[model samples]
Target: MTVLGEPRTADERRTPDRRGAVDGGAWRARARRWWPAAWGAVLGAVLFAVAHRAMPDDALISLSFARNLAEHGQWALTTGIEVHTATSPLNIWLLAALHLLTGGHAFLAAGALLAITLAATALWLRDLGGDRVALLGTALLASSPLLGSAVGLETYLAVAVLVGLVRYAADGRWLPAGVLLGAAVLTRPDLLAAALVALLVLLPGAPRLWRALPVGLAVALPWHLFAWWRFGSAWPHTVPIKGNGRGWFDGSFYLWNSWPDFFLVSFTGVTVVALATAAGGLAGAAWSLWTRRWVPVALAAGAVVHFAALGLSHAPPMMYYAGPPIGALAVALVLAADTVRWGWIVPAGLVAAGVAVSVLHGPGWADGLAPVRQNWATNPEYEAIARDLPTDGVVYSSTEIGALAFYCQDRGCTVVDGVLADPGRVDQRWVAPWRAERPWTALNYRHYRPPAPIPARWRLEMGPAEPRPGDWPITRAPGVHQVARLVPEG
Candidate 1:
């Protein structure tokens, strides 16, 4: 017979706020103090999801292929499923590992890895800077749209390794830092610059350089050895495989145009305020460098070198590669906002608002999931084409053709060429179709010059060639057949 209106006491009463929890006025104070860091982390998660959601079909398909290869043991190395190009295997490995851990859910595994990377990145930033600076840096990184697009990609993997190296260096942990850089080298040879940076930053004061170097070398040796064994070269990861030299100036078009658009898309949908804050921080950092301030100078120098290395590449680096610089920019902004005219808090509300908007928008971003989101069963055409084929069947296709091979491999389907499997194979295949049209070389395309004869052993298949009136003679060639036509399953 308890009274209906009476408030409960002791055991029935709401537990007193925990010792760590803030109450009433104290809650407001804590909120004011911690809001920036919390908002930054939230914003980062949103932008990260957006980029991951919008990944192109080709890239997602490659990742799916890599996962399938590892699950089925088609390839020894975690190399991507396509004719293997020179991209680092770490990104694929990450995806594969996630798939393995999660019982083969490709999209879930990738999404998990992407989330983990974002979280690790924020934690790494916090370790590099203090909590406040880390929060600000993470806010700048997570809210920017580019982060989502690049997460789980090679560029993001490189950046994550680089961030790990920087954190280890900052903590005076030379061996761990070196090991991270070594992994960076395995993943992307261009990260040699970061390795150099780590050495410069970590070695001078290390008490036992010999001991630390070996520790790092030991961890990285297996991958190095494996690369040598597989590719017949120590630096099998470079771009020269495509006849493109090691000169850094080859890929300017990608760096300038594609990267910015990537960033704009990744950022606009999430923490828009972070962009302004990052810009302000970049400007401030530049000013600090001009004034010869040591801390800002160090960060800016590292960032400039990083940006320059990426800029020199023939392929434009992904937006996540910009994380470290963005983090550094966060440190700069925090410093400027707090110490420089007390203007640091200006963007804080905008960051929070942006985060709120992203969260409120919920899961609609799933609409953007493309080839990455669907598994083999969803793509019946590839499976139908590959059905009952030999595991080692010499089929020619793009880097993502592994998606088909994943299912066909059980039937002994052997893919002779894929974009990511072996660069040499892909290059050879590119010339094969042209050569197939000739008499001795009878290229498969039949569109080549000199009226080359078709190959006797090879079958000619045309995939939905658009109407071109002048090409009727070539289209009407004997033995020509339409093998398959793919329409969006959606």
Candidate 2:
């Protein structure tokens, strides 16, 4: 018989069973701590897969650089050209590595990398605003048509880096925060403006700005120096190509024409969410300044500064440029919502409304779920032109060089980017002839012209011109030829 308050037999003690119970409880605790993040990751992956069903046209340009870097050991757009045209250095390197790893399937590799980044962004937001907001933000971001178009580009990765920077800054980890901001700049040079605003917000309260500033400069300076040495200018060649000869920060065309589209694209076609985000972002900035909450202040300031920079630069109405600002607004909104009772309701409503709008106005599920087939159907002309050319040919393509280079991957052919090549060859003579008749055309070729006196040994071919589909005033007037061609002098 067992004595009261004492052990009976050796079996009664059951040491192994007690240890097992404790081990099981520890396992359960660990799972509880990790499961939410795991779920967020899963949700992120699923949404990314749905959103990233088509690759953007610009991705092919980056892929060309990545392919050349991986296969031919060249950093230029074309082998042996030594031109520094790649806009996203970090993205180029990442895609290069993935190109090799995935056996030259750069698009697949880019999609996978984007999915992982999206998941990490979701997890970071989860830490900031609990499971509900995180899930909602992820869903909204993933469903965004702009974000969908940006899947194969550096935009989402930049957004993820911005989020990380803000998170680290908010926690007073200045060094890592600076590192991330620097990384963001590497991903997209234009993010420098946004980074400056964040640093300004961090500087007053966080006295350790010195600790971060040097690190950020160190990360970004080497690339700039290298670009200067290699390309004769630290700026991307596209600056001269697309800046339309205007000084940087000299204009506001984007503010007037592209601002509304920015909001529409960023908010996934939902006007209500866009308006709310703008209102909340501005109000939150003011509130944060009053309360001296530097983190939200930094986010709000970054959004404003980025938008202004884009406006000043007269940037094209591309949705990807809005990624970081939208992300900042979302984070600001979540943080602001947390201050009020039942704060989760706002994000939840935004998410639901965004989803409804997407369903009503965006692509249907059948199209959304469709597998990403090879882009050959839409780009058959480029492929045909590529195939018809000789293996060692050099083709000068006007606008669709991305598709041209991508399809010509195996032909040992090289593409001279019409917009970006031979800045020194630009002559006022070329523009004078067309200025009065075609002002826009004159401006496009004002800063660059094809290399003169093309050697007989080099073959030059032009892609067929696209027909203007409409009779709109802005459309190419009838009988005006789209002169996207390169022909050697007779």
Best candidate according to lDDT: 2
Q: Give the per-residue lDDT of model 1 (tens digit) for 1-490.
A: 0111121344432233332254556576455444544554455455555655545433444465556565765442222332334356666777777888888877667667655665665565544444554565556455444344344455445545656665565445667766776676666666666455544543444444335456666766786566545543344423433223222235443443543454355444432543564576667666654643323334444555665676655443334445445544554554444434545464365356545554555553443432112111223334455563433224444224434534554455544333344445434543344244434523222332221221122111225466343221111112332233222111
lDDT (Cα atoms) of all candidates against the true structure: 0.47, 0.59
Per-residue lDDT over 294-357 for candidate 2, one digit per residue giving the tens place of the 0 to 100 score: 6667777888888777766556555455656776776676666655678658766666765565
Worst lDDT 10-window in candidate 2: 470-479
Error of 2 at 7 (Å): 51
| TM-scores, all models, native as reference | 0.60, 0.73
TM-score of 2: 0.73
